[model samples]
Target: MQARHFKETYSELLSLTDSVPERVWTGILIAGCLALPWVVGSYSLSFATLSLVMIVGVLGLNLLTGVCGLISLGHAGFMAVGAYGAGIAAADYGLSILPSMLIGGLIAAASSLLVGIPSLRLKGLYLAITTLAFTVISTHVILNTPEITRGSTGLFLPEPNFFGYELNTPQKYYLFCLATCVLFVLATLNIMRSRVGRAFIAIREQDIAAEMMGINLRRYKLLAFAISAFYTGVSGALFAYHIRYINVDTFGLTLSIEALGMIIVGGLGSIAGAIIGAIFMTLLPEAVRMFFELFATQLNGLFATRALELRGLIYGAIIILILRFQPEGLIKIWRECRRIWGNWPFRY
Candidate 1:
């Protein structure tokens, strides 16, 4: 009876959304996203749109590292592959942005299999190093093959269009990214409620234990890698369109490190964490820049230059502070807030 009760509880926890409140709140959030572009200024709209892109990419990383317990350092390489793939397809082959993005995602997924098969077998530092090598190799190939990618000179992307409509304005592009983000988020939510998601969690907790329960370790790990790569690739394609430019330096080790930081700061194994982390990281640099701009006049020129140079230092400091104070991340703070309000009039 106890075992049955525990099983029932576990199953209930596995559902995508269990309460009417959750559904209602989700609806409200989606509605807000739909209405945001009409009210915000062009600059704010663009920032928000880019934030949504980062959310999608970080979500993919969450699935792999957070949920599946796979350490990857080559995600930027996958994004580069997607960005370049879409760029080539749209510029050279005259394909629409949507189809080009899909092609990019598919190509990235296929490429993941090549890396995942051999690398997934390794764990910890070995896996990380292997993926890092992939990044290096990818960068070298793109730089050497200048005829196709335009090499270090960079490649310009055409504006994205949908069914004969061009998304030239910031507002229109916001809507496009907003809609795409919603679709991907909903798809990820459903996946997290499915058997595959459970398999990922089990593997994250203990691969040996998961395999003992008859889960195919290699198969699921590769699937996780492929799926994660697909999401990141799609984001990359959109990024190329968003920035209208692509270069070998654009998707480098630092971007990969930032993606990892987004997941870590958000909270592993939680979708909300991924979203929160994306927003936080996306806005942080802007915040820093604004601070410098506001105070640059107050400081000496050399001091001002040093302040700007402290960009890396500032970012590292913030991450360290967050890890030290809230290792579980901002998601835990969110949960606490909900718990406090959800049980209003009663003290915990």
Candidate 2:
């Protein structure tokens, strides 16, 4: 095979090269997802839905920490706000799912201002600690406010009703989540391609140089927080509805850490990385469970009580190994494979 290039015109030059394969693969993937619910068991369908929801949240965090170079430990706190916001709107106000989700996202974005504004002057460990404090404070508030949030008892959400249809089944909810995930993924890609997205990358590379280039650090930073929070909030809303029950502990520090890990493992600042990372992390626990199950008879139930602990240990080890050997993340590995395939039969 010989490599060919066609660039006779400016438009042709600007257009995507070798796009047909990409389109074909994307179409196949989409079709598979659409047909997945009918083919898979209920548990698998539910797992897929959870993966999609996490993808939404991870994409938001990627925009903030990965693209904008903002460090946040309060992602779960923002998610809690969104969850409670949507939960309250639907449970109490009797609003529909769409409106409730919108309100939740808006509320989360507004709350992000409290942290975002202060973050303009903070960086690195200091910024991380600040966000951590915010998470602690948010958790405290949620716990104390029993009347609204239902506190430690948990809040029960009504069945998600979109228009006249009720998303009562796992398959229905999964489809809803899949649609939402696609929209957010597309939105993130567009944002990264736009002027604001360029500014975000510039700030991430070198704030001082970006400022010298007339980029407004404070404005873009704050905007990043707002947008990130909105994405997370909607994700929270979906979560609340998905489970139909949420407590403060549901959106705890563990979730924030997992979101951060997803971005790191997937490849920071890459949209596809976020999606891939979310899917991988979501399925990791199940993989661990399957491993234990496979050796259940041989282990003689020795690891039954310690499964959770072992899972965490294995998870940490895998992350360390990936960081040690492939610091660029799983996306780098993906790119390398693609490059090799594209250059098959010849090494340049």
Candidate 3:
């Protein structure tokens, strides 16, 4: 009786998910995203902006790791190319924010192509090692290349504006970031459902088999890097403008690994996962740090000493726990709940 009941419930869950049209699901997501800023507090909304920046990065990482089956241990370098590129354009040339962002993204993409072309021929660990080397080299190049990057001192950027209005306030910047995140996520979702997405998945599942099935390995591989870098670069560029400044130290291996971790924790090959993961990772650190500081007086030495170390310890512990269970990530849990609720009237 128990086995029969479990099978019936599982069948009902599957049936409900399939019942909802894709268009409807997309509409609901769009509406929810649009409503976030209005519904959340200002501080929370600002963190949402930070998540927005992270979201763009994770989406790109997803393309490389989730779809293309390639790993980039040094994507932070690409992001640096983009951030500095955009920062330079606005600071030096007096270009508008949008144009500066475009130039920055272009610079990152071009650099990525240079790295991808020769290095992509290698697979798995070899590819990762090559990118990691590029990352280390990129950091030194930016720090020492004074003619362009300006060394340890960070560069300040002009406030972003459209015509008359400058996006100078936290609220205004949040709105801008929110809109961009939505558009990019939509674009990502659309891509994964299209022809290029199919090619990417083919490469991911089995590159040799994909090549045998008429997919050009080199062409698609480079294309993935180009696309991924452009997204990360543009976001990096946007991040420079949004934050009001940038520096060589801003782009580091820690950020590169965190970007990868966001996708991993969020769930690979899932757009919803990318978003949820970014939000989780972005907010968790902030919340923990703030909580410790806010209660330091009341908690005394118990919470005050070595708080930063505690934050890292907690984060590492959570990662291990998440991997042990809920390996598909937080989004999968949300979807499961939705499925059960959506079919409550007739649970088999």
* Among all candidates shown, the one with the greatest lDDT: 2
- For candidate 2, report its TM-score: 0.95
- Tens-digit lDDT track for model 2 on 79-165? 999999999999999998899998999999999999988879899989988888888888999999999988899999999989769
Q: Write the per-residue lDDT of candidate 1 for residues 61-146, one digit (tens) a residue.
A: 89999999998898899999889999999989888888998998888888898789998679988988888888888889889999
lDDT of 2 at 163: 75
What's the lDDT for residue 23 in model 1?
85
Ranked by lDDT, the better of candidates 1 and 2 is 2
The best candidate by TM-score is 2
In angstroms, how far off is 258's CA in candidate 3?
A: 0.4
* Candidate 2: residue 174 Cα off by (Å): 0.7
The best-first sequence of candidates by lDDT reads 2, 1, 3
- Residues 259-280 of candidate 3 have per-residue lDDT tens digits of 8888888888888888888888
Q: Number of backbone collisions per candidate, in order?
A: 0, 0, 0
lDDT scores of the candidates, listed in order = 0.88, 0.90, 0.82
Clashing residue pairs, candidate 3? none
Query: TM-score of the candidate numbered 1?
Result: 0.93
Give per-model TM-scores.
Answer: 0.93, 0.95, 0.88
**Cα RMSDs of all predictions?**
3.3, 2.1, 5.5
